[model samples]
Every structure is written in structure tokens, then in C-alpha cells.
Target: MYKHLLVAVDGSHTSENALDHAIGLAQGENAELTLVNVANPTEYMALAPEFLQHESYEAAALSEGNSVLDEAMKKALASLPAEKVHRHLLVANKGVKEMAQLLVDYADEQKTDIIILGTHGRSGLMHLLMGSFAETVMRETNLPLLIIRSDGEA
Candidate 1:
């Protein structure tokens, strides 16, 4: 019985599945849905200075983030009315862990009843290297979380 649901999307297939699930839950419960996309500042900061300047990198990241949010909004609107869906783009200047915290903080600000997100399901070396925002969020937040694996593994 969620009143406000927050779904994090990154234009990936996994996130798309999560969005679909969130939409279904929202429709069934007559709840409001919010779609969030986080832009990691570390990505831009990692780029070589000669290859790309910081200002340009930030601009590109923001643009891509907006595009992801727009695409997610279109898919969400197919299942729910525009009035029932909200969109948010968060800039995570610190890092992945901070990104997870930002999501939690945003959920608090929005008074979201539940958070829905998809896991890429990376394991072993890849998992170790890439880390997981979903895992971090789960560990840090007290709010209810629904995690959907990309390949239906969970």
C-alpha cells in the first residue's frame, strides 16, 4: 500500500524492467510514481584533461542524464498518466556511495513510501571493480526497497 513510489532508472534494460514493475505497483495501488536518474560526477572527473575539460564533461553528463530521464518518462507515461508520474535528475558529485545516499535523501524529501530499482547482477571480479549502487542503498537506507535483477535471476 505505497502512497508514493520512487523508481531509479538509467536507460538500461534492467532499469526498464524496474520501471515496468513500479508502474504496475503504482497502478494497482493508485500511488504516485517518481522516476529518478543520477549523473555521476566521478565519470567526468575521471576523464583526461586533454581529452575533455571538466565543464564540457559536466555538460555532456547532464545532457545524457536528461535524455535518460526523458526516455524513462515516455515509457512511464505509457502506463501512467503524466499527472501521476514525476521525474528527477540528481547530480552525484561525490561518488557512487554518495549517489546512493542522494537517492535516499531524495526519497525522504519526497516522502516516498517505497524505492524500486534494478540490479545489473554483476559478480566476481567485475562486481568487485564496478561496485553496486543498489547494494549500497540497501545497506544505508531504512526505507522499503524492491530490487529487480536484470535477467530475472532474482
Candidate 2:
């Protein structure tokens, strides 16, 4: 029933699984597929203080985001036609919004019927500290979500 589907890819194996699922769903419904990646320069800078150079960090983040989107587009192309699949790379605004919010907002902006994402499956203290992007997206959006866990749990 979905006419358009949005899948978030972070170049992880879990996201690969989610992309596979999205491809199947898109094929079954004859829907358009949009693959999105959000790059946060602040994150890379914070994690690697030695980088120190703002330009390098921003370049790295954007490069990584494009790489992720390109890889996902290649994979999706193998299953879906080039015309049916699209890609978007978003740069996160530091301190302005969380990644989950960015994903949700993008999905809405694209008018996607459903959102598909993979969960890292962190739990307990780790879950509390890292938080769950899938959970946050679900809470932030009113659209339908298909969350695939790292261990094949849905």
C-alpha cells in the first residue's frame, strides 16, 4: 500500500538488512525507494579531538555520508530500477537537532508513506546512554515505521 518508502542507511550490516527489507517491500508494492544518510560533523570532531581542523572534520563527515548513500544506492540498484530508487545526503546542524529528528523531518518532507531503519540493539546502560534512534523516530513521527534489529529481530 505504500507508494513511497524511506530507508535510513548508516553503512552498517544492520542497515543492510533494513535496506534488503525495504527493497522487497518496494518491489512488492511498486513503490519508490529513497535512501538517506545524515552526517554530523560535530560528532566526528567530538570523537576525534586530534583532528582539530574544522574543515577536515566537515569534509570527512560529508564524504562519509556520501559514501554511505552511494553504497546503499548501488545495492538498491541491484534489486530496483535506477528510476525507482533515489538517494539523499543530509548534513546535521550541530546543537540544532538530533539525528532522529532529522530523519523524521526528512521523511515528512519527502512525503514517504513509511520509514525503515535498523536498530543497533543496544540495551540496559548502553541503551540508556546511547539511546535508540528507532525509538526516537517512532515517537517523533506519526508515520508507519519498520524497525529491524541487528539480530534479525523486527
Candidate 3:
């Protein structure tokens, strides 16, 4: 009987799978879904990018990030009514605390009842190598979280 669901998405295949699952669940459970995309924080990109100084890649990358969030919103909203879905693109160019806290803050402001995330599914040798955003998210908050594995597995 959840009314509000906050979903963290990145526009990756894993995020797409999670979006489909979130939408389906929202449809079945009659809940509202919020699609969230976090921009590659400026911190991740050098302010004066070496590439920008030396090449054209920096501008291209910025353009790509701008398009990505909008594209994610379009794809996520395609599944539901405008009234039942909310889209957010946040830029936290710093620590995981900022990222996690911003989502948590948004959820609190929206009165969210749950959080849905698509796990990228880096496991075994790869899992240990890469860690997981979901794992970090899971550790940081008490919000109800639904972690969906990316497609292709059982």
C-alpha cells in the first residue's frame, strides 16, 4: 500500500530494467513513482578539464550529460501518467554523503513510502572489484529499498 516511490536511475540498462519493474509495481500497487537521475557531478569532471584545454571532448561530454538526464526522464515517464510520476535530476559534485543525503532529503520532502533501485549486478570477481551503489545506498538509509537486478539473470 505504498503511495510514493522514489527511484534512483542512471539511464543505464540496469536502470532501465529497474524503471520497468518500478513502473509495473506502481501500476499494480497504485503508487506514485519518482524517477531520479544524478548528473555526473562537476567534481567528477575537472573544472578546467585537461581535455577541454587540449581537445573537444569536454564540451561533448557536458552536452551528453545534459541530454542523458532529459532522455532518462522521457523514457521513465513514458510508462505512466504525468500525475503519477515525478522526475528529478540532481547534481551533487562531491561526496557520497551529498548524493545519498540529497535523495533522502527529496524523499522526505515528497513523503516517499519506498525507494527502488536497479543493482548493476557486479558480482563474484567483478563485484569485489567494483563495489555497488545500491550497497552504499542500503547502508546509508532506512528507507524501504527494492533492489532489482539488471535483466538477463533468473
Candidate 4:
């Protein structure tokens, strides 16, 4: 029953699963699909009191992130209907901490009916280091979320 579906991807296998699921649903429902990737602004990492900014590192990371996302999108769209797929790349620090909310904002802007994403299934130390970006997104955003977990479990 979805009219517009938005899939938030990060080039991970879990995200690929989510993309696939979203695509299948879109194809079945004849819905439009939009893929989004948020490039976290690298400036915040250099916010320490004494450290100078690392321009080169940030630039390189941005470039790499964009390239990876582009490739992932290409792969995801290869088997999907051409007229139904759309893509957007955004750079915002808000996404890093509020991925679900960020997706919801984008969906609201696009009037999308659903948001799809892959859950990395991380816990303990790993989650402590990177935190659950997806969980935060899910908690803060206000949209129907279809989350596919890694290990092809969900």
C-alpha cells in the first residue's frame, strides 16, 4: 500500500538486504523508491581543544564515502525498475546521531510512505564504539521502518 518508499543505505550487506526488500515491495506495489545516504560531516571529529583541523583526511573520507554509496546504489538499482528508482546524497552531522530521524525528515520532505534500512546487529563493545546509529534513527524518526538485519535473519 506504500506509494513512495525510501531506503537508507550505507553500503553494508545488511543495507543491501533492506534495499532488496524495499525494491521488491516497490515493484509489487508499483511504488516509487528513493535511496538516501548521509555523509556525516567530518568537522566534528576535529573539534578537540588543541588539535588543528584535518582537512585532507576529511576530504578523502568524504570522497570515499560518496564513491562507495554511488557504487552501492548502482548495484541496488541494477535489477529494479528504472523509472521507479531515485537517489539522494546528503551531508549532515545530524544523520550520524539521528539516522532514523534523519530518514523521517527526508521522507516527510519527499512524502514517502516507508523507510527501509539494514540493522548491523552490533552490541556490546562495538555498539559502544560506534553506537547504534540505526536504533537512534528508529527511535527519533516518525515513519514506518522496515529493517533488515545482518546474517539474513530479518
Question: Using lDDT as the measure, which candidate wins?
Answer: 1
Best by TM-score: 1
What TM-score does prediction 4 earn?
A: 0.78
Candidate 4 lDDT, tens digit per residue, 1-154? 8989998877778887888898889888889889887766564465663453346545544665677678766865776767788888766655367544566688889999988888888889998887886788777777887878898454
- Cα lDDT of model 3 by residue, 10-82, tens digit: 7678777877788888888888888776654444355556545424443444455556657766765777777
Ten-residue segment with the worst summed lDDT in candidate 2? Answer: 45-54
Comparing 1 and 3 by TM-score, which wins?
1
Q: State candidate 1's TM-score.
A: 0.90
Worst 10 residues of 1 by lDDT: 51-60
Per-prediction backbone clash count: 0, 0, 0, 1
lDDT for each residue of candidate 1 in 50-86, tens digit (9 for 90 to 100): 8774367667678778999999888889989889999
* Angstrom error at residue 1, model 4: 0.3
Off by over 4 Å in 3: 42-66, 124-129, 152-154
Which has the better TM-score: candidate 2, or candidate 4?
Answer: 2
Q: Model 2: per-residue lDDT, tens digit, 18-93?
A: 9999999999999999999988887676665665544677788888899899899988999898899999988885
Error of 4 at 109 (Å): 0.8
Looking at model 2, the pairs that clash are: none
